[model samples]
Every structure is written in structure tokens, then in C-alpha cells.
Target: MSPNPAPRPSASDTPPRRRSVQCAGPHGLHRMSYLEWGDADNPDVLVCVHGLTRNGRDFDELARAMAPHYRVVCPDVVGRGLSSWLPVKTDYQLPTYVADMITLIARLDVDSVHWVGTSMGGLIGMLIASIPDNPIRRLVLNDVGPVVTAASLARIGQYVGMAPVFPHFEAAEAYIRAVSAPFGHLSDAQWRQLTESSVKAVDGGWAMRYDPGIGEPFRQTPLLEDVSLWPIYDAIGCPTLLVRGAESDLLTRETADEMGRRGPRARLVEVPGVGHAPTLMDAGQIAPVRDFLLAAGAAGGGR
Candidate 1:
């Protein structure tokens, strides 16, 4: 008898569609790349955005798990991933990011979407969700909040635009492992996935896939104290869920507590032993998010 043929991958296991849409910025129009998974006609949409210096691929596992229930769309957010770089570096701020998302949503032809944003991505979600009649119906602020500590800002500033070129792929992986230690104990395969998607082959060596100029606007501003956006947080009316690394320095326990008490009054979940942020790769980390987003009547009130 002939050997059994290789099994075909399941729908959720299949790769997502690589798509792009043009977005207007301060200088001109720029291309934003995104990954789409699940039923193209499914109107139940989930928009997952990555943190600063990261890309849409960060949500690969989460998207796969969620694709069965919702149409998952993860964007590279302007300067990162396969997206175009802005000619004006200062345009890398939240306003430009929010506008780009709006354009992406229009292209998707969706009336509303559920948002899962990590760090900088979370801030963008907060801004978009705060708008009157905005498209975001449910929000997941992963390991971030309206209040960000100055120390964490300093830590992130140290390397946002370093633009280092590695001699080999291993070197690039090592660098990612070092900086992303707070991602909390990922396996070798997981680490490889993160590194491969984060770097690109250049003339001399491998380099990060983002524009170095993306850091210009951030470095120009001095962070003297904790960055607080209570007004923005207060403006949001949709259901919000807040996930924090238990030992995170960026989003303190105190701030997360207050976040539960006010506007949108997000329900909080903490991943033990992690710091800075949770990668949401493993089953444990993905459960709360999946549950919250898939739960019935999540729009009425947070769980």
C-alpha cells in the first residue's frame, strides 16, 4: 500500500492573506500591510495591533485560535512589518496611527471591530475607541494602560531606533531575546518565530524591519514623569479588558486598579511571573482574551 499522504492543514492552521491599503499621512499617502484570517465574508471582525518595534505577526497564534470564531485582521501599523515608512518621522505619533487604522477599517468594509493592542497599539485603540461613534466595539489593552511610567519609557527609548545590523540570523535572534526577555519564557521555536518576523536581510547584514526614523518623534520629547491620559481613558464607552504582566513596570498595579474603577472600567487579568508585557502566544495567556471577546453580550459590560 502507498504511504499515507501528508495531512492537509486545518483552516485555522493555514496562513493568513497578506493585504495592504493606502493611508493618508502628513506628507502623502503610504501603504499599510495587514494579515487577514478566517472567512472573508465574516462581519465579526477582530483587529490586533502590535507594540512599538513589533509587527502584526506577533499575533499569529492568537489569530489562529480566534479565526474559527471571528475574522481576524492584524496590521503592521505604518512603519513596521511590510508597511511603508513615513517621510515625516514626527508623523509616527498616535494621531497618524489612529488615522491609518480608520482608513484600514474603511477598506475592510466593516461597521465595527474588536481591538487587541499591545503597548503603543493599546494607546491607539484607546484613542480610537474614545471617539464618538468609533468603529471599535470591544477593546483589549494588553500589558498597557493610560498611565505609563517614566522608567519604562526610558528603557524603551534606549533602543527604539538603534537600527543595528547583525552579522548573522543568530545574532539578530540573540538581540531580540535580550530585549524581549519581558515577553516571558518563550520556547526556541517561539523565539525563532519572533526573530524571523522582526528582521530582514539587508546588503551588509540582517536589520530590524522597521524604519529607524520612527523613533525621532519619541526621542524629541522628554519624559519627566509618568505619562497619564486619564481623559482619553475616560472617554471610551465600549467594553474594555486590561491584561498586565504581574511584575510589569510599564503598567503598575495601582494604575490597573484605578483603570477598573473608571470609564469603561476595564476588567483586569494578570499573568504571573511576567513583566513589561505578555506575548499571548501560549494557551494560558490566550484564554482570557478569547473568552472575553467571544463571550455573549461583552458590549453590555465587562466580565
Candidate 2:
């Protein structure tokens, strides 16, 4: 399916707002950057978070599709994109991310929100939704679940801390496509958009925008090989949707099936011909999410 042009902004003359929130980290304080689309004052807010080594702009297509129905907010999780990097490598874990999200939600001043989280971001959403009195009105877990595969972790870690320099953006786009092929089919335009935000021109060359030291935590943690977050997943009480790429190596079919059988009894949707993750950048990818989120809105809230 072809991707839809982004909906005309509620006020077409204005563009998506770039906002920041001051958040505390183990080292001190940093500002997390976010792009807000749709009605800022609209009570209906949806937060879309990106995967490991990915920044928030990865959701541009997805957020654009949902903006008319929601105050779509996408955060460049600290240490990536325009957000500040953590000084302490160990601070790159989920706890800090969750805290930063809470700060962001508070800034939005909305009582509750819908969430679409991809990969590592999904884990963060699970943790947040598990908490008592949390505000995740509905949850969408994209290409990640309680259990992750060791092989997938190994594959990801291989390039997590990469610091390759490119003479031009096209060169960097090639590198990104090589590593991100696991994200499955994406148009040249989509991949190019991702590449534009993933790097920066520095010293007459380009380098990744995120802090390379973030990889230290990946190396330090033993959780990759033997991680368990079922207790957290099971505690989530909100309506949930779990989206998995049919060929995803990280979120196994077995795990995806089990997700449907238990804990939130999450509604499951699978996209064929994708692996590791599905970039909801096209109509085929974004339809289920739009339908799910709007259904939830119609049933109770998000107006």
C-alpha cells in the first residue's frame, strides 16, 4: 500500500513543534527532545517511541498518519537525535528512560495517553504500564516482548557503538540500509529520511547522532542472554496490542503466540515479509495501529 501524505496540520500554516523537557539522569540533568504534531492542547495524545539505536523521527510516517486523531508526540529518547546524551554509560538502561518518559508525559499535561513503542521502547512501555496509577490508556508493543533472543542481541550489539564517519549523507544512507535491512522493506524515501536524522555533519564528515558510550551498558548487562520481564508484562492492565513482524528473529513466533494467550491477552497483528521489526511507514504498516488506537478512543477516551 502506498503511504498517505501527512495530514494537513490542524493549523496548516504551523509545523510540528519541537519541544524539550528537563530530565534527571544518574549523572545529573539532560533535556530530552520531542516533536509534537497535531493539536498540542488536544487531550488525545499518543506517544510513539523508537527502537534501540533509532531516534524518534523513525516514527514520522506513523505519527503523521495518526496526528489527525491524536496529539502525536514522538520523543528522541535521550542520547539520540537532538536529546542530550547520558554521561554515565550505565544510565542508558530502562529505568532512566521510564523516568524521562514520565517527565515528558507530565509536560504534556495529559491525564492519560496511548502508546506505541518499538523494540527497546516497548520494554519501557511495559514497565511504565505495569506501574500502579500509570497513564497508558492503551498500549501498542511493536516487534518486542518480555523475552528477547540472545542471537538477536548479538546481532544488534555488533554495530550498537559504531562510530563510522561518512563523507556525505548518501554514503551514510548506504551504511544505514546495510544495518537496517532487518527492518524489512522500506522505500528509498523512507530510508533516506531515517538517514538524514541518524547522523550529523561534524569536522567536515558525518557521525552518528547518539552517544557511542550507550553501548557500554549493552556490553555490561548480562540480561541480553538471559532476560526476563514476564512479571512486568503480566502486570499491565490496560488494553494492549502486540505487533510482530512475521519473520522477526527478536520476537519469536512462539513468544508472539504466547503473548496472545496470556497477560493482557494482547491482540496480535503480524506483518509478513519483515524481520526484527516493522517500520510503520506505509499504509499496510500503519492501518492496524490507527484502527486499534481509534477503536480504543471510541470505546472510552483519547478525545
Q: Point to the candidate with the largest lDDT.
A: 1
Local accuracy of candidate 2 as per-residue lDDT tens digits, 108-163: 98788889999998998999999988888789999999988888887788899875
Clashing pairs in 1: none
In model 1, the runs with Cα more than 4 Å from the true position are: 1-10, 299-303
Per-model TM against the reference: 0.95, 0.93
In candidate 1, position 76 carries an lDDT of: 97
Candidate topping TM-score: 1
For candidate 1, the lDDT comes to: 0.89
> lDDT per model, in order?
0.89, 0.84
Question: For residues 149-174, could you state the per-residue lDDT of candidate 1 as single tens digits?
Answer: 99999988988989589999999999
